[model samples]
Target: MGWLFLKVLLAGMTFSGLLYPLLDLSISGKTRAPKPNIVIILADDMGWGDLGANWAETKDTTNLDKMASEGMRFVDFHAAASTCSPSRASLLTGRLGLRNGVTHNFAVTSVGGLPLNETTLAEVLQQAGYVTAMIGKWHLGHHGSYHPNFRGFDYYFGIPYSHDMGCTDTPGYNYPPCPACPQSDGLWRNPERDCYTDVALPLYENLNIVEQPVNLSGLARKYLEKAVAFIEQASTSGRPFLLYMGLAHMHVPLSVTPPLENPGSQRPYRASLQEMDSLVGQIKDKVDHMAKENTLLWITGDNGPWAQKCELAGSVGPFFGLWQTHQGGSSAKQTTWEGGHRVPALAYWPGRVPANATSTALLRYCSIPTVELLESMGACRLSAWTITRPSTLLGEPKLVMGARVLSNSTLPLSFSTWKTMLQKLRPYREEAPSTRRCCQRSPGFLQMSFKTLLMTTAPERTTLRTLR
Candidate 1:
């Protein structure tokens, strides 16, 4: 039987001094103090096929392609969810969206936000003596305890939610509104749940509102400018930093600098993608110049494109989405298909990450803290706790949410030790109530096996896959 599995991965530094304890400590006795700087460039609604390395027809992403070739390319990396708010919640907390109470996007009128009780990656890194800054879209929550600054980031700058909202002129706040749709003062309420009314979108600097109805055309450039400044400030302070550039580009209402918007060659949407590539290159150049060997850089999309937007939303490569179909099945940004959450990830850490390596290992955004803690070599710890409050029935079909206790586990400092333990546990699977087993073969780059049980009424639907 063909086993279906989720591929998760974490990139380690290639530094000889810090390499031993992370992967396999028995191989070497040396351990260096880790103070590596981290920069996460998160693209909004970009697809796996949007990169030049993944799909040729899209704009050339020379910098990202170069980064992928230089460091490690994760072919099977996945976000926790297909949509923005939920996926972002999972990315930061390592818990599923349902568990975090952020199962859907937060509308301006909506009272929901990422629960303040959950621990974010920023909080973990902050405790580790690293400065953290957040730039760009922060859909987690717009107000109160859920704001970025309140969450963990020492500095926050960007919009509170998606860009396509809060427009008085655009009907339903739909950019390039459908001509056929009737337009009357354009104040029509959006059909989607958890979305706000068409009010002017505001840009925030920390907790204060800086710009209302922000100039959508120059948002990307603004995000980049803030990111570079943060990097420079952190680098000059001689402190380890986490620069989280949550870019707002390649999403709907595509915008770019005039020079990049060559009408004949690159469409506005494609230009936005290219512009993002340039931003990535700029960040890499800065990092290389400042501390090439002491920094770990990551570039990836939050999730797949909004298939409903057609070419404006970008491409998802071989995978399918909500509006797009491949063969006989359908997959899209809001679904559980690979095209929805499987995004392209590029990790570059000079000397530590192998050159031009591709890893098919199962990697999820939730494992980010694992990577952060492991990369820092116990320089930080994720404090695990839970709150058992009354469940809030949210999302479609109204299901119970939150109020579950979380048990935390840590990865061993030795890979071989963990591998042996996994092997020993393989034999006990048959005796257990649920089905579970390790794979017979390992994968290229880095390999780790995980067992999964599929509970279903149909016997044929029940199966497992090799995670490695």
Candidate 2:
């Protein structure tokens, strides 16, 4: 089953690459323009409800909401994985954890990152003559060859891992509130606090450590400055560029610039969210000024908020995952629940993407369609397909008709679907021993089945049903 799934995933990626040019030609008309600059802004630990446009109760993301209004919003977009490293690896490689060899978060002291053999999106774009730069958190690998520079990013800036992973001069606002790094050479250990205080967080510029024990308060400003400069430089050079900004806004140890209007009224998380949104707005403005008609700005989160952070974490909105919560475990961040994987996604391209549109088609990280979209843009080739009508690239929900459905009597389904199916089969709350065992082991089983479903393609409908 594993081997078959791997082959299907590889085939899907290859097929997507081939189909992307046709989709691109359908949008850009008969005369093709230069390759579009791609700006992908990735939020760390941001929830599906964090974007104000997605959920009404949370009103911090003004700029992001504006972006959504002027672009296409995806309601059913999901991260490749629930955790950090694996999700990031999948995003860059267009492969799952099983194929990418990164199933969990990489440690600060970890020697390896995403395996060197795997090709990255940046690498592909770079090969196609695009300038690639990555700013912000890069948790894939920090050591020698596993670094972003080695991974095909022309230039790299920001922390090697999560901000909270190591102690810094300005620790910012965490749940328990971590202390500042000691001035003395000796490492500071707090028996009461669970946060790290020994090694200081280092800020990187390319391969060099520009700042040790980075000032959390000033980091946002620095990131904005660097990102804007990169975009301007690349635009002036007349080369299509790929700028991947992995933001640190919605994550813990929230460092927010104080609001001028009301200093003490707002929460820290909301303040930080506003700061993040403002930074995005500034970047967007820069893109508009330099290359509005030829750049695609895509924004999304790595995964859901860290539920363990309580008030500090972002809201998950409707994906509360009540079934898991009833069993006394978190359904956010590390779990396979909707709250853990479902994230807010927006795509903005002034004349290219349809404005104020929403798509409900189910999508996950490293999906064939996404890969096709990126490769189509990066490859910069137009297909024989003629542009007859105005439409957005991946702006509408894609329907796959006449496909096969493979299922077992106890099929692995989505959380909501699984609940309905389970109730029809047997009461989940009061289940027999065999049923309980099946339910306990269904998360991983379901994920595998879901991937297979996404990759399967055929001429005629075929149902593979088996009795367990």
Candidate 3:
């Protein structure tokens, strides 16, 4: 009997030893890490059909398609607003633009700045013990008060608004290229030029101008390099970070890759998209190579795709009933149509979020904060946001119509418009900085040469201090 009891006890011990590791893993899976890095890549005006992963007939984006294959995608993601500034407002404050006092582009210059009353995601993330950085277009505001530096980003780079929004019809020091030239009508041009700060299209680092009216591609590479460095830094320091990469592509004067430019049609757009995909691939490889599979990476466009029509570029897909009282131009390109807001979204955290996990939870650009995204990370609580109301959090849909929440202005508040808005929006928000005060002001030189740095080796980083 003693011998039999001894055998049973030894067997139980063996079994427990084998199960111990598995039990620990199960418990850890439910717990939060000290901190995890977050990467949000925002593509401008890219459409639902534009991605190779989607069923778009003309566009071709292979790397993006591959990402979709490797990760999960939401067919119904949305943008905060159709236009750049409003959308940016929604992204930053997690509230509708109307809530912040913006309704239309009619008096865009005077009204569209991101109000100081509201806190931005950058500020929230920074307060949560994460480093933040913003790269690409910042269409929220231009005044010193509305500038990115004051909004919570520790570092800032990229354009202040739409590439051509500020381009003038007049050709002079402070003016734009001659609109008199017929070539200007339907031509590809950079709105970035020398301004009071530096060149109008200058590269801004924090509050200083790093380069004058610089080319976006060069700046994009610099931004990416800095982001990668930030990742390395974050990993080494054991602090979580939020890296926002705003890509200026598939939008403008139709700047396609040279190969695609030869075709100068949808194909050019395809090429540009593919290039952007390649850049994404580069970032992904870097992160996966450097960190464990637990890091979260999210990629999506800011709004709908734009199509080139006679002289203006607007939405590509058929997005009906998008314009409100003050906004216009075309259907979905900037409208509230599904094509306008139904941009693509992909999230990945190999070990955490289930691979190929298709979440149709009706994600809105402004609702990201309500996703318990920060809480899941053990971050601080956020104050009131228009999107994260009690109803929405309780598995109920927030009625998304009516006037601006903060401004008290009327809007085209209707179910159809709301549906269109929800269907068309993508996963985008104004980027918060990854770290405070990282980008020293720079003096940029874009016109020195126009050759693209793409198809070149990876950027290892060089001194841009002299440019400033």
Candidate 4:
């Protein structure tokens, strides 16, 4: 009888798994989610061990832990670039920074913008009949050719760029000496451009601006509401959907809030993070309500915190340059030390991705190509695939960084190789982190650049220019 019961249990599990596609296609009148509806929840500038699941022993992060237990954790996930615009460009294009001419932030300087020819994840999904909508920050571009509408998103609703960008070309939407032109009544203007406020909100429904979002503390609820509506609509229409919800929290002016605003804010060190966790909880509830175990959810950060803000403003936490430097590299100052590039990365899918599967596998953001996703839906064939760094291909006239630099390519180390790299890099590893000891192991293809060290006036600052 016990054996028979075991057999029945196996049969039940098998039946459920197999029934998913048939029921989804037939009764529901919709195609099964192709490789799951991908949701990349990009946090602003959180740390490597900030999540509860990653540092449960010391830190008090609950919601993130629950997520890890139910999904897969990429112990070694990497960002495309160290900053937001370039990093995001790398993600959407599936190419490294240089190829897209956006290796730097677009706010302060004009060094980067998404390329025109590059196909976006939305366009790919749209081709395969997946509804694509961006519900958060759209920092990629602001103009016609470069906007999300042009890139691939069928629907777009989010802030144009960083809230911290210098004041706009026009003030108060119009009036006294509009920077250059009075523009028109159609343009947007916010007085809180340099400060934090819930008023000067930037809101979009589809292509039209419906309202200006205020009180970012409630941004999560807004996204969740939109996501739920989208999922419901997709469920009714019987087509797969891709939802990219980027949150703008744990980043900014750092004001205290209610429990709902910051769930885990009790700890002085990472209060905003706790609030962010609350936002995560709301998202999870919506997913469960939709019963989207077949959906894929990927969460990560935009870039390291404002290093200077961390130092002077008391907003950013411990990450070296989270508040200051354009982007603090993963590990250390100037180089891909792991502090900036190797921050938090998590993926979860119900009834699909193996639960508790903590993958140390070297995963790059560029790997999520639109074609691959479409292929899963039997909608497209692999015409071609190239993994070149975009920033290098289009921009940088001199291209002096990588070509003339001539740095040794260091592969990610295992238990043994890491020890060797550590021994080789010992002089600079002294001030790594106050908590965990640096592991002797790294990703398989982990490489370090000598340019940072070689350029610094002294060998003491050799670690300044580590590679990403």
Global lDDT scores for all candidate models = 0.61, 0.72, 0.52, 0.51
How close is each model in CA RMSD to the real structure? 17.4, 12.8, 16.8, 15.6
What clash count does candidate 4 reach?
43
Model 2, span 155-245: residue lDDT tens: 9999999999888887777878888889998767977655678788899999999999999888999999999999999999999999999
lDDT (tens digit, per residue) of candidate 3 on 108-195: 2554377677776677667768778887787777667888878877778776776554332222211222222223335453445322
The per-candidate count of clashes, in order, stands at 18, 0, 42, 43
Task: Show where candidate 1 strays beyond 4 Å.
Answer: 1-34, 168-197, 259-265, 321-330, 364-468
Q: Give the best candidate by TM-score.
A: 2
Per-residue alpha-carbon lDDT of model 1 for 1-468, expressed as tens digits?
Answer: 123222111222444345546556653335535577878888888888787655545446878877877776654556767788887776676556656687788877766689887777777667667899999988898868888998879999998888765542222212445212224556556566223445767889998988866766667778878888888899999888988877877666666665453455756666777788998999899899988888878887778888777667777765543222534444557766657777878777777655665554343111222332334343211111011111111111111111011111111111221112223232211111122223222211111111110111123322121110
Q: Model 4 reaches what TM-score against the true structure?
A: 0.62
Q: Which residue pairs clash in candidate 2?
A: none
| Ranking of predictions according to TM-score | 2, 1, 4, 3
Instruction: Give the 10-residue window scoring lowest on summed lDDT in candidate 2.
Output: 401-410
